[model samples]
Target chain A: MLLAIAQPLAWFLGFDSLMEFIAFVIAAAVAYQALKGYRLSKERTLLYLHFSFVLIGAGLLVDGLSSIVVLLSQFHRGFVVLYALGYTINFIAQLIAYGLLVFAYLQQTRNISAQFAATAVVSALFFERNAFAELILIFLLVYITAHTAMNYSVSKATNSMLVFGAFASLTIAHFFFLMFILVPIFFPLAHIAQLLGFLLLLGMLLRVNQPS
Target chain B: MIPGEPGSSTKPVSKYRSQFRIYVDVMQVIQREKNQAKPTRILYGANLSHDRLIKYLEELKSLGVIQESGTEDKVYSLTQKGIEFMNNFKKVESFASAFGFRI
Candidate 1:
């Protein structure tokens, strides 16, 4: 879900929502592909991947809708809290989504129990609902980014490189999210980076399905 | 359990195909040969030894994805389910490969 800028950026009002909606579409498409794979092959890893992207898609949809609602409501005091609510939901969804990805990778190489990973995901729910949430997301993205980077190193496939670039972009996006607190300008930059990450994934998906 | 795949006991030495992967490989070889592949063709295409090929062929037959014909000079072809499976599998493979994963 990339935990977008969340708070109103003021300058780029409706445009950010549109970007997130586009990202949600990409995430949902990825999730749908994973679901098809799971239904056909019944692979546990594909199931994990399906759930991961579902959470991401759902989070983006919620956040985007909330932003649109707030904008339409003219930023009334009651609507301002909706932004915070949207952020918290997206943050939690990202924690679970990225946690599932990490668990899949861990299970691929090792035999870690699902219970252990579930515990970590649930524990993330206890984090303070503030900018500190971005830090936790950044930590998970670092692990996932490093995993994809290592995968690209070994596989040396263009698709793998694109996946790595996507996660790397997301990692940068979250960093920009963290930096946005100090400077509001970082907010739109974070959304742009986040959208770029999903777009790279979309590019890889298109290339993969190019009837080779 | 092939090495480098999920929860395998062995460490990564080389890309040893798992039984599931081998099943897909044989099926794909059948599909590649216009869905009416001979054993030698599957053997050459999937790079399997003769003994393993017979064993897998028997397994696939039992699973009802393939059937044998021509008792004297046997030929293999995919069943409707097998054809549908390959079609679905192609999409799945493409999707997983995009994420650097093998299914």
Candidate 2:
């Protein structure tokens, strides 16, 4: 819902989709790894992580496909709806994905309860972007980033540092997205920041799976 | 035997560790002892009772990750598969720990 660019930029069309596609692959890989860990260790937190990344990958795939569709359609009036549909789906997916991540953190700290369940998803029609939604996402990312930061500080491990950087980058990307409403250039900047975030996450994954 | 927490030090002591965790802990003890450990070392290192350690050792042996030897003392060492499993487990543990989640 933080997406403010009703129409994606023409110049960055292919590149944006490519970046998102790559990010999608990385997200899916992370999810798969989390699932493997969950199966091996039966960790509930890993399960939550698996689902969160799954949703993130799904959202990225949908958005990337929609962007490709828009680019191929040449912004046809009829096809413009696809853009909205894609963004809306991606928005909802991210909302739930981040919410699940936040819930996972809360559960880790034993702060989660039934009361937070109902407030998890704020129902809204698709294609509706608002400050409120953006604020929620930023809030969630901040908490997750803080948690990762603490993790890095305690462990002083490169992988933890990467994860912390990735989340911090993502938070910045969302902030840029929120600003994109006023500054057109912020759209591309947001995408670049987001790609960097995912790339950092990919780095962590590679490190995690690297041969011992 | 003594079973500490799982994966990393950050995790609080839960009432029980999963079977998988116990297996990893036992293997870790073997690894820490330079890949050859006695039954008593495993029992003490993994924080398991004598009965539980015996049960898990049997299970690990059946799973092909560990093997027992020594006619008189019953020393244990990791098999090839067991070594690979431990390697993989270390990776998974680091990954989970990076996210502040214990596996």
lDDT of 2 at A97: 86
Candidate 1, residue B65: how far the Cα is off, in Å: 3.6
Error in Å for residue A158 of model 1: 2.2
lDDT of residue B56 for candidate 1? 91
lDDT of 1 by residue, A38-111 (tens): 77666678888999999998888888888888888887778878877887788789889999998887767656
Q: What is the TM-score of chain B in candidate 2?
A: 0.85
* Per-residue lDDT of B49 in model 1: 97
Docking quality category of candidate 2 according to DockQ thresholds? acceptable
Q: Which residue pairs show collisions in model 2?
A: B1-B43, B1-B47, B1-B48, B2-B46, B2-B47, B2-B48, B3-B47
CA deviation > 4 Å runs, candidate 1: A1-9, B1-19, B31-37, B40-59, B62-64, B79-84
lDDT of 1 by residue, B1-103 (tens): 1112233536552465667778889998999999889999999999999999999999889888899999888999999888877776887786776565667
Clashes of each: 0, 7
